[model samples]
Target: MSRPALPELSLLMVDDAVKAALLEDFGRAGDITSQATIPTDAKATGVIAARQAGVLAGIDLALSAFRQVDPSLDVSVLAQDGDKLEPGTIVARIYGPARSLLTAERVALNFLSHLSGVASATNAFQRKITHTNATVVCTRKTTPGLRSFEKYAVRCGGGMNHRFGLDDAILIKDNHIAVAGGVIPAIKSARAFAGHLVRIEVEVDTLEQLKDALTAKPDVVMLDNMGPELLKQAVKINKGQAVLEASGNVTLSTIQAIAEAGVDIISTGWITHSAPVLDLGLDIEIG
Candidate 1:
């Protein structure tokens, strides 16, 4: 089946990241093994193949790595991001100088496999709550340098993105409430400091806090660690006042119940932080 159209990520957007990864792999010595063993003129064809079932992502970024290593390398993308693949799927074809292909293989696979893993994991959560109104959203818990790429992968897997960073939105967590004396004070402080355009979301751990947050009239209220029963009551109390988000201790076994409790968004960190890397291999055919 054809893949759905996803937003185009320009090479410029990922160039720095790809370059940093290549630099880390190459160091100052370069691919010494390839230089010593392979003939400089040798050419080869290679395939990026999946070893297991997954949702494909980061094909372009992977290609960028090869291009950065050798601009003359030819890469033909067979599958775009967001496409579901069975085991042994060929994602892309590469033909290039054997030395360049060998040098870029690991760095390319690192980006492709890790982002595909995030996409696949996010897809699993998205599939679970297909019947519900709750949207699966990713949290700020992501690889330090790859948040944008990881969030893009989440979108590819049909998951929504929460705040990109603390600067973009105001989320009053438990610590903020504690420091400010209460939820209302925290929300008020945020409102006073933030511009009218900034959105204020307060996180509450109990019904009492929820009531206080409701009184503050923040843009959104996150129901932290609330079970299904409390979430239902919170939903009813909210009465369409603010967007309700359910978070904390969320897992595949419990997401459905949380979603059924009528929250607008369900946020989880595992999709970005703990997703296992997808198994993708690059096999080269020497010519």
Candidate 2:
């Protein structure tokens, strides 16, 4: 199936993040090495190209990095986010003062490579389950202070996002179940306290717990660490009662089977928290 049009990430959010990253990297003194080496008026042109094949993301943040350093820098985005990329693909071309380009290089590639990695990982998961009536999803386990950016990357790679934070959705986890006394009560408490629009999801480790939690009518149920056989059983028990989300121990190797087990969503942590950064680099043109 074709992916939906990618959603707009707020320019304000992108600006704020780029500004903070620039501040952190530019701390105390600016790029002293660039300042000392490159002539003040010298200009350079370069193409930020992929060093390996992967999906694309975070081009805007990379542009923001360049502009934050030198607004006069001319950048042409040859490829947009969500595009499939290959080694030597020219993602963007830049002509700007040499010093500023060098100064902004790390931060630009940091955003591009990292978010592209997330997108690529999510894409791998998507490809695994393309035949099934299931969607790959990302969880709250994201880089601190960069959740929105990473979640946007998940979208770029055609994955659905789970709750952004605790406030948006009431997820009664195992701990919440323990502290609240039991599965049914925890969901009940959340139901009582939650607004009409709020969705309540509860995590259950056993079939018994899943059956019990369903009684309280949670909006969704996360079947933690269940194998495909158990998941099939759980799906049978669910029988369209509530949305079933299969989570934990998910990897590229295991995702397709999990999807085939009939869970509505497969929530994975590694895609965002641990996906390797795609390799991309700036090749300065000679002449």
Candidate 3:
């Protein structure tokens, strides 16, 4: 099956992150083993290939690691982000000074494998609910410094990102509701404080709370942990007045039912926070 290409994330988006990672790995002396074992002028070729099947993401991040580690290294990408991968798929190629290549190896693989995992997980989860119009979305539960990269991976895997951060939108969760005394007040306060451009989404755990929250006319309402049956009722009660987001208990096994219940958005944290890393390896050929 042909899959459409996703927008490319420019290398600049992840430049600093890549540099930081490489710097952290380099430490004070930088690749001491490589420095000792390999001569500075020694040349080597490398092929980064997938050892397991998965989707591709974070090509730019991987490139950033290589380019930042040694600007003189020659690097080229064989597969772009969002592309499907199989065991033995060639992701990229690098030819450069042996020491530089060895120095950059782990950092490059780390970014590619982790982000690909996020994309792969999201793809699998979204496929479970393809029959329904429910959109697969990622929550804020992301690695602290890697939120943007992980969210970008979510998009690559055919899922949507909820909100980048608290500044982008107002999401009133259970704690906020409790602190404000009720859902309505929490949403109302969020609405009043936010400007005309900001969107407000309130979280509710029960039908009565859903009803009360609707009265405030927030942009979206999150149905927290409601089973399929309650979700169906919430859909009927909502009547398309607001975007209904079904969160909690979202897994590959439960996603289909959640989508069938008629919610517009199915948001989960597992895709980003708990995704396993895709296995990739750097095979070096010494000259």
lDDT of 1 by residue, 16-119 (tens): 99999999999999999999999999999999999999898898789889999999999999998998988989999999799999899999999999999999
- Which residue pairs of candidate 3 clash? none
Per lDDT, the best of the predicted structures is 2
By how many angstroms RMSD does model 2 differ from the true structure?
1.1
Candidate 2 Cα errors over 4 Å, as ranges: none
Among all candidates shown, the one with the greatest TM-score: 2
Model 1: lowest-lDDT 10 consecutive positions: 1-10
lDDT for position 224 in model 1: 96
| TM-score of each candidate structure, all chains considered together | 0.96, 0.98, 0.95
Global lDDT of model 3: 0.91
Sort order, TM-score high to low: 2, 1, 3
Show the lowest summed lDDT stretch of 10 residues, model 2. 1-10
Tens digit of per-residue lDDT, candidate 2, span 1-287: 67589989888999899889888999999899999999999999988999999999999999999998999999999999999999999999999899999899999999999999999999999999999999989999999999999999999998989999979999989888889999998988898999999999999999999999889999899999999999999999999999999999999889989999999999998999999999999989898
Kindly list the per-residue Cα lDDT of model 3 for residues 1-287, writing each as its tens digit.
Answer: 67655666656668988888988998898898998898888999999999999999988888888888889999988998888899999999999888888888999899999999999999999889889999999999999999999999999999998999988998998998888999888887887799999999999999999999999999999999999999999999999999999999998889999999999999999999999999989998544
